[model samples]
Target: MTQTAEAAAENLPARRESRAEKLLSWLIRGASPAASHLLLLPAAAWLLVFLLLPVACLLALSLATRGPYGTVVWSFTWANFGRALNPMYLPVLLRTAAYAGSATGLCLALGFPLAYYLSFYAGKRRETLLVMLMIPFWTSCLVAIYSWMIILGRHGLLNDLLGRLGLIQAPLPLLNNGFSVVLGLVYFYIPFMVLPLYGSLEKIPRAYLEAAYDLGASPAEAFLKVTLPLSLPGVFAGCLLTFVPCMGDFLTAEFLGGPRNFLIGNLIQNQFLMSQDWPFGAALTALLVLSLISGLYFYQRLEARQIEP
Candidate 1:
């Protein structure tokens, strides 16, 4: 063979062998890069056995029929699902949604400024102020409900003050209705809304705000154009957390609002407890989960859109 041709022939096999070795290396990596991932197996098994299994059971109960005694009759039926879609249920669902939405909106309105102030202006006292906010987290939410009752009841503080002022012959209808329920929900959930917003707002680079100021933008303009928009993810996250819990919240509706305001949570609680309708209650629980999941899905979609160009 010619010297050049011999060199080419000799090198071609080496190059081909190198390519083959690389392909083998990639195949080996692709097949078992996480071969020691068996560490996750136990946790996965625990979740399946506990969390997922219970949800599966609840879902099955939703699909199954309720017996005369409200037991889960194994005879499969979609009647429960159909009943949930009825107009009567629709109104309750809508009312709950409206209440939750309003609470979320109010939470954002009230929490946003406080969170911004703490994050941007509190400075050396930020830790102390933030610690104060977390004090409520340590307390029982149920206790707060009772406290609200004491404050909003007929002989409560407002009534005493107003009666002294001769504003009315009787106390206003502040308790035992939708308004107080919303108020309690707002009070209970405001911290949830604040913490997330504060977290997001705190992370906002000082450089961005400085840039806006340096570019001759006013403080108001800097916040609106830079701070508010950047902090929206936290706002959205907090709203979602607050809204979902409020929708499914029974205690707030029951303790403060009493009979005039019965939420879906009350109904579910009744079906399972007093009514002896486990299957029906399970169905109701499933429906609540589904609704929450749907709402979360939409919220996440909106968040994604907010993120996109």
Candidate 2:
């Protein structure tokens, strides 16, 4: 009877512990919803304060009038926006688009083969090659651009070597043109193109390609029909990444390209710095942001259609 009582005493504590745990879990589930929400609120507030606040300020600055002292006045004017929307700005926008388009295409074309070879063929060296691609990004983009100018200029290695080989009678004109701008853009953005494409291609299960090949489809056919289509999202993402940055890049054009190659970013810079017109600069930024947002929205819809049944 004494042993039985001891067992009952042990069982009572065990039962009590189990009940306490269950009650605590229930309480946490019920009462902790607001506590969890509190965690998310800080990040939301940070974005509002840092990101959205500046955008709000820029918009306000765009709408406000500029005083004689270049101070923002509390007056609404459509003139800043109207100048941005004028037809003269159209060529600048189109030229920027053209340059950005060429660079994006080049990045995709060059990056695809490297990404493919590394991801699929490099085997043990995939990580190493990826590291190499990322290594250039560690250095400032301006430094790499300066290096390109030296490499391609008249007294540069390329021209010197070509002269020795008698391939050209004169030093080639590689700098200070749209071609150089495109080259710089592609060089800077190639890594961006590679990573997203590599991600998409990596997610493509090997069995799908094997199945396609086993079913009498050739290598090219399998890729065209299955692999490429599956990786469309990555391609679109890479294009957008290249396009957006290329559009906003003023430094590349100023350093590598000449008088005929000023883009919207350069124009925006001029308005802000040289002209000392904060309102116009802000207006241009707002318009560019809208264009980017609209582009992304359309791209999302296109992606949805492809993924959906």
Candidate 3:
């Protein structure tokens, strides 16, 4: 009877331990799904609060009317959107598109070679080059744009250099023109273009090139067929990065471009700050956002098709 009682005492501890382990296991199992959702909640909430809410408000404002006192009126109206489509605004939109498109093309032309060199030929200096590329971003964009103003102004560095070199009789009208605006846009956005191209180019295996060479393909052929096709994703990404921001860049046009070179960004800014037409400005903003989203959707579909076997 004593031995039997001792065995029962030993079994009680084991049973308790088993129950504790089961409880822990069940807790972990049940909490895993909830924990994953909990982890996503902050990001979802941030998007909802910041991005979606502001866009919704902007959309609502776009649909409403502007009051005489430069305030938003809650009445429904399509006049704002209709005004945005007028012939006066079409030229601004076209010019904006032209500048952005030119910048994107120039970025691709300049950045692709640099990225290709960095990926294939930089060797141990790759990191240094990348660091140098990123150095411009360390400073404020406004400061950089202002610095360009100094360099490109009539009496500024370029003019002084030209004078010393006897290149021209007078300081060229370099600043406050379309040329300067495009140059500023290119300078500011080139790094964005390069990084994505580098990412794509670096991922192309050397073995693929070697295999192509073994099959009697020249370097140009290999690049044209293999490298270019594989790198389309990066090219599209770079274009989107460069183009979207360039389209909406008011500061570059404001400082570098004169009154004649104003783009959609400047127009929008004027509507809001100078004209105080909140409804029209909101309509313009909504249109720009929707257009960009539509372009992105089409690009994404194209990318998916390109990636498919």
Report RMSD for candidate 1.
10.5
* lDDT (Cα atoms) of all candidates against the true structure: 0.87, 0.87, 0.91
Q: Model 1: clashing residue pairs? A: none
Write one digit per residue (lDDT tens) for candidate 1, span 219-262.
Answer: 99998999989998998899998998999999999998778688
Q: Candidate order by lDDT, highest to lowest? A: 3, 1, 2
Off by over 4 Å in 1: 1-38
lDDT of 2 by residue, 1-309 (tens): 999999999999999999999976765676767755665789999999999999999988888777776677778888888888889886887888789989999999998888788767999989889999999977798899899989888788889999999999999988888888899999898888989999888989999999999999999999899889988888888888888998888988988887778888898898888988888888888887877789889988888888884
lDDT of 2 at 104: 92
Q: Which stretches of candidate 3 lie over 4 Å from their true place?
A: 1-31
Could you tell me how far off, in angstroms, the CA of residue 258 lies in candidate 2 after the best superposition?
A: 2.7
Descending-TM-score candidate ranking: 3, 2, 1
The prediction achieving the highest TM-score against the true structure is 3
Tell me the TM-score of each prediction against the true structure.
Answer: 0.85, 0.86, 0.88
